[model samples]
Target chain A: QQQVKQSPQSLIVQKGGISIINCAYENTAFDYFPWYQQFPGKGPALLIAIRPDVSEKKEGRFTISFNKSAKQFSLHIMDSQPGDSATYFCAAVDTGFQKLVFGTGTRLLVSP
Target chain B: DTAVSQTPKYLVTQMGNDKSIKCEQNLGHDTMYWYKQDSKKFLKIMFSYNNKELIINETVPNRFSPKSPDKAHLNLHINSLELGDSAVYFCASSLRGESEAFFGQGTRLTVV
Candidate 1:
């Protein structure tokens, strides 16, 4: 019940195209959803986040689409670039618990 | 300045050895956490501390223990290292009750 399942373990997209990664959570208690980007040999870093109050949140070229009813969320990258190629992870957190439940990472590759 | 820093970026040890990973956060956050990323790239929360007090502990093995001497520092101590113990460990910090977490440059541990 604590799992956050992510799809497309690996994704390849052309530069200037759109890159999308999907994730679903089982626990309805999760109120906060965050996406993290991790380069090789580096720790995961916060990319964008959204709360149950909002359906979507956009930060620069990164956007997170959330659906509270479906218990699902996705990360969209506009104008995908090679620099954006990395492993992306989706995580859910119940603020009351103060711990994050992370999904299996998605390795994204943007071809030039 | 790095927001979260963990010592010994790479640690290679033999089986049955005991080791420790040190972590410190300069973000003045009241909550700190330790996450382990397995070979499958699944990140799992092992422990969490708020204001130097142990709060969340996942179903990790008893051989793994976490200590927080201060709010800014959280350390992990592992005893009887086994081959399965090899993985990349990350340290993160966040404000209490907030969802945004800052992570460190993970420590890669390889047990032979």
Candidate 2:
């Protein structure tokens, strides 16, 4: 199974709150997991990423929590701001295959 | 400078028409990919090229073909486009064996 399931197709959070999006993958061979943020009329950009070796990775206000055993990962945006309103996608890739599988995007709206 | 750039950001055509989307990456990456995002925001991989060689091809229709003349450029050609072919196509590039991939602004194709 190459699918990566993501929850909450849409999420609304208040500014200064926490925004969380979850994703789970079926392929155990996936060693790299990355989260991408896409704004209106823009391409998906790399927000943050995590590997199986680490349980979590934090970059600025964005953090990725990963669980190798559960084959799941999530993106946490602390102090959610209106500027963060956009579509977020979680992706997985097996370095050997180099095929990046993406989850159905989650549209996040941070209310001001 | 843009890392990954695709041409013709908006393409509108009728069914049975053939079209092409051009992509180029300036990151000197050895791998490039084409992804399709449907109306529901579900992203799927159609093709991937590494070192100007066809590597990963998903279960896409034969009407879709990808050509890479050089490592920095990857182009997608479609034949007999159908109504279902309407989607936003994205071009991405990454270094071999790396988890980070840069994406283009995407080409939105509308087939009527």
Best by DockQ: 1
For A60-89, candidate 1 gives per-residue lDDT tens digits of: 899999988898899999999999999999
Candidate 2: Cα lDDT at B90: 98
Tens digit per residue, CA lDDT, model 2, B1-112: 9899999999999999999999999999999999999999888999999998999998999999999999999999999999999999999999988879899999999999
- Give the per-residue lDDT digits (tens) of candidate 1, residues B1-112: 9999999999999999999999999998999999999998889999999998989998999999999999999999999999999999999999988899999999999999
Clashing pairs in 2: none
Q: What share of the true interface contacts does each candidate keep?
A: 0.93, 0.90
**True-structure lDDT of candidate 2:** 0.94
The CA lDDT of each predicted structure is 0.95, 0.94
Model 1 docking category: high
Off by over 4 Å in 1: none
TM-score of each: 0.98, 0.98
What would the TM-score be for candidate 1 when compared with the true structure? 0.98
Candidate 2 lDDT, tens digit per residue, A1-112?
8999998899999999999999999988998999999998899998898889999999989999998888999999999999999999999999999989999999999999
